[model samples]
Target: MDNDRAFMLSHTFLLKSVKPFGEGLWQPGASGAPWRSDAAEPTADDCVCSIAIFTEEPGTIDLDGTSVSLSKGSAIQLRSGGRFSVQSGSGSATGRLAGWLVEFFVFRFGDSRPIAGGFPLLPYHQEIAVHPFAALCSVVDRITRTADGYDDPTALRKQAALLELLALLMENQQRSHMLDNAAAAVKRAISYVRDHYTEPLTVEQLASIAGVGRWQFSELFRRLTGKRPLDYINTIRLNRAKELLLLTDDPLREIAQSVGFRDEYYFNRKFSRMFGCAPKSFARSGKTAASRQPLLPAAKQARVRSSLTGEPSRLVVCGGILGDVLSLGVKPLGAELAVMGRQVVYRDKLAGILDVGIGGDADTIAALQPDLVLLEKEGVAASHFQSAAAPVVSFRRTEDVTVRLRAIAALLGAEREADEWIARHEDAASSMWNRLRSRIGTGETATVLVQIGVQLFVMGNRGLAATLYHPRGFSSSEGAAKLAEGSERFREITAEQLPGYDGDRLFLLFSGDERSKREARQLTETSAWQSLHAFRSGNIHMTEAKWNYDDSLTRGQLLPVLPHILSSRI
Candidate 1:
């Protein structure tokens, strides 16, 4: 790699926003309505990394053959050689889309040494913490202010800051380390791919499932699991193909296409490479037969059906956010209940009690007289629900969806319902995952900054803090977690404090009342916030105050909205 090329490659440019290069920067489309670039493909030498921040202006880009409308605060990093065009449309109803963009050159030393490929994006296996966006803006401001007289000292400072920013981005984008969390992400991704494989499964969509960036995710996945990202994806696709081959006796070409393979020959070759036999041979050998066993036995299946269609049934759901309770309760035959106070005991002999909050007192357990009680969170005890004459079911609140479901089902004498619910939800979640996988088959993944109340958290290996963005994806950021937690206060920091805060998109959460809205407005007005790319581009979202002290179902409420929020932002 040339020294300059290497230097560029070594330095990652964080883009907070992009606007046409012109004055009226604050005005949407002030540079001119977005238009397609008629220029031919430019050489690497002809391209330079340029980051710009802008308000949300309607804009379109022809990516490959598809036209993608760029939402406000949406950041894009382009290689010098890539050819693209942009056209502007009407601004968002809120007026201007706010955000900033920072462009840094990438130097490819040579084909043999890819700067990113050579470095492990995340060395640690923990959740990524969200860095304040203000810190990123400060770095960009400093660099731009001294651009005319770029001295050695300035260059050195810039280099160091850039490196720190990259480090932070990598840290925030690391996948959750916990096996269950990782498995959930994988399962969700698979579901998405299966559901929308007919569309496109870009790398960006997959990263959305894993809640990380395309590049960082690629590195992390490779480091943790010994397979390349695409290789792993193909493995999943092939497995599905094998299943189809055995189950339905679908034609080889149809099965290949159904699983995302465009060419039958290529699919067969790839299948042979991985499984040591052609698709036909594998199907004939009953390899796929082994994959088709009902996840549960006949008895279990019958039980599940009975539970779903049974008489006015009782559901003991535990360990979900308050929104989950509301969603579940509103459903027919769904009675939402929570154990209050501490020290609830389960006698195991009595029937379960579903306490539905009479006034604010869960003490009504004694008044209602039930068989079992379910408790969640800390500070609630078994003795509280003992008087209700029932067994108490208690479990830790985490991402262990199966364990949580099992506990709840046992209490309600609806173990079969729990199984069926899990099966159904898992199946639904899986289908969604497959659709996403197919959509962004291998596109670039964006870096995201999630803001909670006072602190910013990142997506790490534990996956505890990751939240799904609605319509299509998930994001790992401190802010996102904090929002999920429904925090009221947030840390106020300068842009300089957050280094890699540049290229990532920002998702802001706020309490619903007028006061929270006022605070959100105040935060947006701050110089630090304005400087950060997401704020300037209107990428910042004022999320509903779903998870407050009074409302404990934050996770439940946020999960469904996640995909929608993410899709809108994109």
Candidate 2:
């Protein structure tokens, strides 16, 4: 933030021939070999600092015991008193290392004069872009070419070249720093919006929170959220108003004020524009639906919070694991709405939660400033969430549902809830299975067959198979168990192989697409399908194909439904 200081390079020496000594303003050092396995590599000194630029096939630099890869056109700025060595004999066709080492001290202009600002260092392995690299290499060439003689003009030429090199480094540093600052500012501003949307807000205030000018802040905000600051704020307000319309019976004026709207007139216009109806009309429609019956189980009211903060912890679910977190009685701040062509069974429970797309990215997650991020392993990279400056815990979507629930609860600091929920689920499952024993015997084998288009796969350890194959309920057929031995969730097989995997009971699922449904009907008519013991005995249960998840929420919802499905078949 200070504008009083500017960086400069001073006391320059080119270490080409011999190691330089004393404080020579423009001294060309004695002959020395380039950094390589066969040469004497440079080491850090408490009294000196240096920058090394490599141009040939690169090697690794061991700085203070950390191996850093050196690429062509990349530079390393060495700090004082760190051990430095280069590993040689790889990465180049000629097996030679070509690099230039420039030793200098950094100074800052203070009070209209130069002051020592210590030896400023760049990152350990910063790669210089092509244009800058060429510019830097050209300056280095000029410095080296002019430094051979010790005359006054020759020294001036070397100093001029060094000054240009320093300018290039400083400019790059400033540009990089500006970009980083912009991202951090946008993140902070968006977080402020989330935490304080109900209060008075202004573009200038938000920009101030980001520590940048208003224009810059707006540009960065739109880049991340695809909307101007005012537009985004309106979106959050409108969504909250929608939730209130369904969950409470407050008047339009009161609801508008509660969600930061200036008055009912503005709220009415915005609501009408966004949802294609006036506020009162939308509420009437919702009330009519509720009169018929509660559309969904009321969302858990008690929010999950951090023990450290006591206030509800802002959370983001970046993968299909939203169901796991929801099962633990924690509604995340944001979640992926759906996956695999079906909405989550508890989609109605996602009121007031932002849809963070299918898989979240660094900028969006960072903007939320969540206390923690719950991510699923598939289709998400844990590193991306880590860069959001939040703690991230990843779970495999296909892992045991109980294991995933416990892990998520632990991340949320809600272990007791997970334990209690699992106990209750087990009890419910036991009761459901017990009631079905009269029609479906224990230890009877079952297989899940799924038809999507022309392909058929046996559900192995994942999806419905996870719900069906319980010690007290049913077991997988021998062939299905063999398929489950592999790591994949399902295995594709031909119709001829269907009989081998057939069991005493079958759960036949087909995709909802018209083509897949037609294929399923065709498969059912084939002799291979008609010969199956389950099919012949009328034990085949047809269910919606998309209910193939093993998340805790899905499993809980299915416990009561499974009995109805089995009994209907009987």
Candidate 3:
């Protein structure tokens, strides 16, 4: 289809002047005014259009042979030569329909483009949303008020109002069309992922199928599915592997390869992290008892019984609580490091710690003969760690850093260290908030956005959110508050949702990954982002991606420097 002939009309039409022929408000019903003439009107040489807004109740209209149903706040247009009729209600029901109508022609200023040549096959019907519906109604009211004076001195103002109405209609149509296309494309991509999950896949390849940029594909995928593309793929692979572990006697390496994973060791680590138990252990207990009993070797079970003691000397950290454990002055034998290892806030303190990769390898952890194992509630299960022949203690990563710190301290017999860390953090936070009170409002709202890969998230009660949302400091925006109330640490959102979630102040969090930085820059350049109040007022701030981690070390580090970052912007 020609660009000018589609719902997204060309800019050339915008250059022409909108000249009104007639305008009126009418109701169609048993006793209401008639919309059509007694006889059918023939096509005219002049290119003209009739626009209508359904103000009350539902209605049906026939443009040529196509039937369109219009609900309240719906807008439609018809070309001069088209066969059209309007009636109240839909289908067999006869009811009342109230609306405003305007007939207009676009007069060319200088260019001689054929106005009648590009009328859309059938006019598009759009349902205006609450905000834009009011704007459209206000413009229509202006046109109605000025209809009588079209030939008088106020003609220019009336023409301008008509142009505004056209602009609003076009803008709404384009936005709605884009949103629909994006959603459909993402759905197609998801369907492809599920059908061909065993095949190798890449973001670029999936985006090609979706007909979108990789960055946009990533964001939309997360917004719609609540998981990153790779993560989702891994979930599929891991689930299939779990079923194989129960249904067959295949070796671990064969099972891993059959489910798209190339390395048996990598598969083992991910399996342990996701289900909290190794595949061998999960298989040993059978499907019925898997969750309840992750059996260990006889020797390891004996070792576990002997190690549940007053103080644990050797520790294996299997989750994010590594930071809290370190803060309490206890270093573990091994720890699961994040993918961005060099950027971790506590990287300097991990001098001799074994890098067990993310979610720690159960076999490697067990081989270390650790007396105790620390795991996160969301990560590798405590039973998995127990099967490693160590006393396992798990903490919810979403808990306040102080609470987690103290719990780790008590486990390690270092209560003094936990108290000192808490005291230091509290005093620093109080001092920072007090010093900047005059610079910031009493309850100035703030929102934190973090970019991971190409996905953007509204930080909830984790990471930088925990650091920023103190009673004496910045308050969470309405959108941020709602997200914090949920269990997820962050909520993925599209660019169009920025206005609703945006606050008085904005913080953009990005990781050291080049892709994440590029995504952040692209986000700031978008119209939705640039139009935000925080962006316009220069109240946007930056927090490194490392600081976005939900850990005691990151939270403690944010306390002192965050004041300077915000005060400088103010």
Candidate 4:
């Protein structure tokens, strides 16, 4: 379809300006520029509606506080009395924005007005593929090309075209609804929440997991579960808390953070609401969680017992626990070392360490014949290692990671060193925050972005983003919060969500993986990548994956280097 011909009659929807069913100057506007729309305020007396179609490049439409991306061939419903603007995908001259726009006003004809409980329409600002594209083109062409545009024949023709378009939209919306239902996208999101409920969760992150919009996901979840997403997450946490209360004797505060609730008072209230009493009262009642109970009685129950008199006299580290042990100044006698993969970050620091290959090569472990073995409780370390040459200990999974590190330190006779290191880390973070706080101010936000393969992840509280969220550190950007505070440490977001992560500064982590690096390079070339606030302000910096995450040694090393990265932004 020719954009010029379609747009010439585009003014006053249904081709040509006419207030056929209403008493207002219905106007149609067309835009094909590669730029952002200025913020427009809606008039109180006039209620307007329009449909915008992407013709060239996709851009984001900010309606009120919500941001949604519109892709090519996709259209969105625009209503009056709401905050609205169309933002270019990026600032580059190439890949400029071009789209079809139609706007109309309804001032009421007599007592006529739009019907109430109107078809349970979709939430505002959401984009959808318009089906029957050929039919819509036909209708628009007929209405606009007519020589007698304002005659009775023209009016009748316009009304019919309007109805046809409405029908097509209704049909298209249903198709989208059915797809969402069949996918059970909300159910998948619920599972992600249940698993990672311990981390701070946001609706955006959950919706992304489910491959749906945040608004639609919330609505469908409420319809299916009869509760809000946050309410459901709380229920899951409470149930886990109940099981812990019955099975273990961990403290209430510890249990609270363990289950994802950061506030004890809030946890107590929700617990009472769900189980009819406080966490303590629930635990004291000796009530077992009915659902998590084992189906069959056990023939034998085994416990992980320690045979060591003290920390292993000679330590052999295995698996991903390399960073934790290395942080305490204890050199592992033998560890899984490699040039790529998990050990890549620690390569330069761990030069001469005996390469044990991957965690537990029974032959290698036996060959090292170390006095003690420190390993994770899940894999080889958790397995029966009686046949190995050394005694093994597994780190307990808990809310406080430092607890395990401290235990290891005690065994290695580096208690003072560990304490000193902790003090140094804390002091350095505090000093840096204090020095930068005056310039950045409180609530100034920053976001850390990570790309692996073709996927882009917003790094959450588990990495450098977490360190920056110190007491005096910078606040997380709105979009960044969805990932940083959510269940997953990293979340994949659509290009439209880039604005949500927009802030004063952005940290991009490159792991030196060819696929990810290649994709990352391609991303920077797009208009969407060029248009970012950080990119425009020159506040985006390239760094390694290790510095952006929550690993202690990596973060400690990063504390000093980060100031230099932010020097320009500050």
Instruction: Give the least accurate 10-residue stretch of model 4, judged by summed lDDT.
Output: 299-308
lDDT for residue 157 in candidate 1, whole number 0-100? 72
Task: Output the TM-score of candidate 3.
Answer: 0.45
Cα lDDT tens digits for candidate 4, 1-570: 265334323323232242211121223233222122432422321334566655455555556656555554566766543445565433222324445454444322342332121122434566676655566556545534546346887677766676565556656777987866734877777657755889999888888888787787887776555468888788768876876675567899999999999999999999998766788976665532321243112321111112222232246776556676778766676776653235345567676577766555667767766666766534343344555655465653321234445555655556676666765665577556644442354566788888766667786666677787754677788876766434456778777777878887787777766766566767766788788877787667666675653446766777767755554231
Full ranking by lDDT: 3, 2, 4, 1
Clash number by candidate, in order: 120, 5, 1, 13
**What's the residue-level lDDT of 266 in candidate 2?**
89
Assess each prediction's global lDDT (C-alpha) against the native. Answer: 0.44, 0.65, 0.67, 0.60
**Candidate 4 ranges beyond 4 A from true positions:** 1-313, 339-348, 377-381, 384-386, 389-391, 395-401, 410-413, 484-486, 493-500, 512-522, 568-570
- How close is every model to the real structure, measured as TM-score? 0.37, 0.44, 0.45, 0.44
Clashing pairs in 3: 276-381
CA displacement after TM-score superposition, residue 86 of candidate 3 (Å): 69
In the range 485-546, model 2's lDDT, one tens digit per residue, is 65468888999999889999988887666776667777788899899999888787777676
Please provide, for model 1 over 1-570, each residue's C-alpha lDDT reduced to its tens digit, 9 standing for 90 to 100: 265345545544432233333223232222332123534433322334433333334344443444444443233433332344444432222323334434443444443211221223333212222334455455545544445685778677766665665554443444224434655565556556545664546777787888765776665554433355577568667766755664455688888887888888988899998766788876665422212433234565455335433332322323332223232222212223343211111112112334455321445445544333444544556565555554444443332344444433433345565545544554554444433332221321223333445544332212212333322343434443343344322334444554344424555555455766566667667677778666555555445434222221333334445444544541
lDDT of 3 by residue, 70-119 (tens): 66566776544445566654222243435655655443455443354223
